[model samples]
Target: MPLPSKRYVKVNVSQQFNYHTEAFNHLVKMLYPKRNTINKYDYLIDKHAFFTESQKQVISKTASSLCMLSEFYRDQDKFGNLYVTREDICNAIHILQRELDLQNRSLLLPPVLKWYAMQIQYHFGSDPFTLKQLRLQLGKSKSRVYDAVRELEHQKIVKLVGQRGHAHVFELVEHI
Candidate 1:
């Protein structure tokens, strides 16, 4: 049998205004794959029912800011695959929250403390952890980790729980 001529048709798959919701949802999924995280975002959005349109727009802008921050903090492996840890998401959220906090003009935590907070949230959840463990995990000097821990304590983000030998045990006041 004679072969038929081959043909190709190009379909545009670019995002459009009509696909805004889908795109937003996809971005949310990418940033927060966990059901609990998605629920948190949904709850925040649901609370905007009484907010003015401008305020709602600010929330959308914060979401975009989070996406950008997440990309900035993403790590890459030797194989070129990207990795976004819970720490990265937490850091992004903290940055966005600081930017959006009009009433509380307090400075955001230093990068080291932000990193520590995320690590605590990721590794220990609400449980207590020792400074020694954090130092080992971060591969930082003892003094450096101690200073960061002190800063966290000063900010009321973490509370000193107890002491084990020379190491100080602390627990997160709330998940960052």
Candidate 2:
């Protein structure tokens, strides 16, 4: 009789899994390609002069906590695809705010203002931005975004640089 043929098992190969920490590390590397020697947070704080030292520390801690919480509660679907919804992010922010309140500390800036500052710093950086651009990015009413921008300008965090067509152009103040 011929020897029984061996059956070979086929293994399914999938794309490599991406963890939140790895994604964060990759982002840091991309943001600071040539400054590997310096701490990323410190470099970012130094680069953005609008935030006070206390605000910087608070923002950093809050961001780290949010990332941790988001990762902990990350969802996976039937296909093993990892994802986070807008609701998840909002919940995380609410939890973080409650925790801070319980600890007798509050976010240094108003929620809207803080969010606006972060959006500007991360997206627009030193580049000039218009109210229309901000409104489109934030999905807020033109008046609401204008008010927030006015508040930021009052705080000396941003300056009215010029006008672009019918919209007013603003740029983050390099120094307070």
Candidate 3:
């Protein structure tokens, strides 16, 4: 072949692109074992006194933890009654599985989940379960129900609908 110009380079873009894909994937796997590097950095906030990437991540995670801990440890019901019963827990699990497109499988509920599930069920038509009703029906304390509601609310299966100091209203988001 005769050269048209000395500076002209015969580049086969498709062939080079194929090699680039392979090389890029290999390097990416080596650089990020979990392949979550991009998202991890994309959501990074700059409210920390750190310079390095690892330090930034540590500070960010720590801040997030503190925020969550404060919200969880508050004296009031943060969200609301989240638990219902075994069936309701199954409903939540089923809803989440559907949302995530996971395979469905029948299983027994955990004790804690059962407790919460009962909470949701016991107050199905009620704004909030009365302390007497909860104590009598579930054989548990008011504090236990309050904590269960907090835990379940965090899971998003239920919602606390009442304003502060009002008759507690718990809404089941997953069930009719």
Candidate 4:
């Protein structure tokens, strides 16, 4: 006789994402070798600054793959350490390829909208932001900024949480 299946799994979203982000950041630091200086451009991801195509490809693949892995973990409610295996690297390359195709479509979007999305991701991370704040940062009019935000919403990249007067609160959509 055999006992029925008995299993238990637990996960903490905050801890899991923190560990994954830290691991990815460490890998990026090792690969890109940031300048040892205090500046605004220090943390920016500039593929053009890279010396070789291979490095850029590796970075893109690894990042997208890590994001995908985190998504999987989130879905499964499984929390664990990041281990970059050969299989993961290979799958990452494939994921990167698909993402590149998606990016091509993304490129067709207006640059302002794209910039808004990037700023939200880079500056706000998971925090909510307001349309007024975005306008102030980009030095654009309310209508112009709202247009971009609307486009992002249309593309399922951002979402509206609430609005107050001329300020509309928004947050980035994950898995984008």
The local distance difference test score of each candidate is 0.59, 0.58, 0.44, 0.56
Count of residue pairs whose backbone atoms collide, per candidate:
0, 0, 9, 0
Between candidates 1 and 4, which one is better according to TM-score?
1
Q: After best superposition, candidate 2 residue 71: deviation in angstroms?
A: 47
Name the better of 1 and 2 by TM-score.
1
Q: Per-residue lDDT tens digits of candidate 4, residues 1-176? A: 99887586575754554456457756755654531211122123342343245534544446544544453442222243233443444444443432233433344355766777887787778788898787788788998888888888866678888877776789887522
Stretches > 4 Å off in candidate 2: 1-108, 174-176
Estimated TM-score for each candidate: 0.39, 0.38, 0.33, 0.37
Over all chains combined, what TM-score does candidate 1 have?
Answer: 0.39
For this target, which candidate reaches the highest lDDT against the unseen true structure? 1
> How far off is residue 127 in model 4, in Å?
0.6
- Model 1 clashing-pair count: 0
Which 10 consecutive residues of model 2 have the lowest summed lDDT?
Answer: 12-21
Residue-wise C-alpha lDDT for candidate 3, range 41-159, written one tens digit per residue: 22323432223464333333333222233333323333431212233223333333322221211122346855566566655643455334555677778788777766556555557
After TM-score superposition, the amount by which residue 12's alpha carbon in candidate 3 deviates from its true location, in angstroms, is: 40
Better of 1 and 3 by lDDT: 1
Check candidate 3 and list the clashing pairs: 83-116, 83-120, 84-116, 84-117, 84-118, 84-120, 84-121, 85-117, 85-118
Tens-digit lDDT string for candidate 1 (46-160): 4634444543454554454454445545554565434545443344445344223333212356666778888877878888889888788778899988888888886667899
Worst 10 residues of 4 by lDDT: 34-43
Q: What is candidate 2's lDDT per residue for 60-125, written digit by digit as tens?
A: 544443443454465545644335344433443343342222221223357878788878877789
Clashes of 3: 9
